[model samples]
Target: MSDAGKLRIDKWLWFARVVKTRSAAAALCEDGSVRLNGSRVDQAHKAVRIGDVVTVALTGRIKVLKVVSLAERRGPFSEAQHLYEDLSPEPPRFEPPSPVAEREAGSGRPTKSERRDLDRLRRPDD
Candidate 1:
């Protein structure tokens, strides 16, 4: 059993130092990047309970955790570390960067027009 209290998943993540900030946690949740008890939870204020399994899909990695305690306030690392138990295995190790894609024949920094095209490509089409 954990201390009795309700806390937001995002708040808990930030307070527990699982993420650098509450905003980051919220974004993760919104993007279906976070799961609680095996289901994706998209609300920043979704209540969290002790023993609940939390899964965070981060850049190229997944972090699994078991809720151990709750805290509303962001605190020192020592205090934050007490709030959760990491169930995730170490992230896979990788050697020096391998080329993920073949370079174009004349690849160079994007020109202004190319930058605009890049921005257009990045825009979410509705």
Candidate 2:
């Protein structure tokens, strides 16, 4: 559907909705967080076409996608998803850190010296 078979990596990413905006896509590329066909791509203008693979290091996640088609405009999620094949592996599950136990109310707050001791326990570097 695209007139041009070739597309800039940033533009493609934005059009596909992989990123929120063209500038955000450019920043992701400029920061050296994007890889094209296994090679690191630091420039947003790097050209991409069908069958190319892109690796994006998003915050707290990594996406591996294969280009399926080129999009001319930013579109809805359903439409944008047609542009690429998602090959990123499922993200590993993370368990939340355990919450610190709290002293019962009316037990009274710890004294200043006791508070310092608790702080030391929490921060070993102190």
Candidate 3:
């Protein structure tokens, strides 16, 4: 933690375990995938302070996190979780519709005799 109560966004992200590596965090920032208080951030050196909202766009989801504190080093998962407050919305849930074709229980496949009986029913004695 800096005496000024500010840390570089990339370092903070890495310290908080937001990304696998610091370089990845810096690249994310440089790619404009990070937003500080709703403003786009394209630099990794940008300063981040407590109580600031940081929005990040990942591969398939967006994360909104509020900085709670600054970290001095990359720490354990439990410790890293305290560095920020997650504000991301819940992901949508999809429920598949029931199948249209329903089969009777214990009915495997029709026997050869069953097929002949069905065919005779359809021929109408002709």
Candidate 4:
């Protein structure tokens, strides 16, 4: 809060709660999964300032955010939300995944009938 102009991207990510930890954020950046202002950046020490746009390849989808302000520390979700403005593209339509065979915990291997059912699910031509 003292000076919002001198913040690093990795720190901002952690401060904004985009990642669970600063090390994780640094790793995300160092892996070339982060783009700053449309250019790929593979360094955790890159400086980020207000109004800069960052596009990141996250686990499930890519996210784009605009830096709105700097943060001094990792904070609550509500506080983190104030650090950046989300500009990510709308995600594609949801498609529920095919049902998977599930059994109770500690149930061990599938029973004969269950195996047959699973086999049928695996190969509809069966």
User: What pairs collide in candidate 2?
Assistant: none
Q: What digit string (tens of lDDT, one per residue) describes model 3 on residues 1-126?
A: 432589999999999898999999999999999999999999999999999999999998899999998988899999899999999999778778675444478888778987677667668675
Model 3's alpha-carbon lDDT is: 0.90
Q: By TM-score, who's the top model here? A: 2
For candidate 1, the 10 contiguous residues with the lowest summed lDDT are 97-106
Best by lDDT: 2
| Candidates by TM-score, descending order | 2, 4, 3, 1
Give every collision pair in model 3. none
- Of the pair 1 and 4, which is ahead by lDDT? 4
Each candidate: RMSD: 7.2, 2.3, 10.3, 5.9
What TM-score would each prediction reach against the true structure?
0.71, 0.82, 0.73, 0.74
Worst 10 residues of 2 by lDDT: 96-105
lDDT of 2 by residue, 1-126 (tens): 584579999999998888888999999999999999999999999999899999999999999999999987788999988999999999999989776646778989899988888788789896
Which regions of candidate 1 deviate over 4 angstroms? 96-126
lDDT of each: 0.84, 0.91, 0.90, 0.88
> For residues 5-87, could you state the per-residue lDDT of candidate 4 as single tens digits?
66888998899888898999999998999999999889999999888999989999999999988887787899889888999
Q: In model 4, which residue pairs have backbone atoms overlapping below 3 Å?
A: none
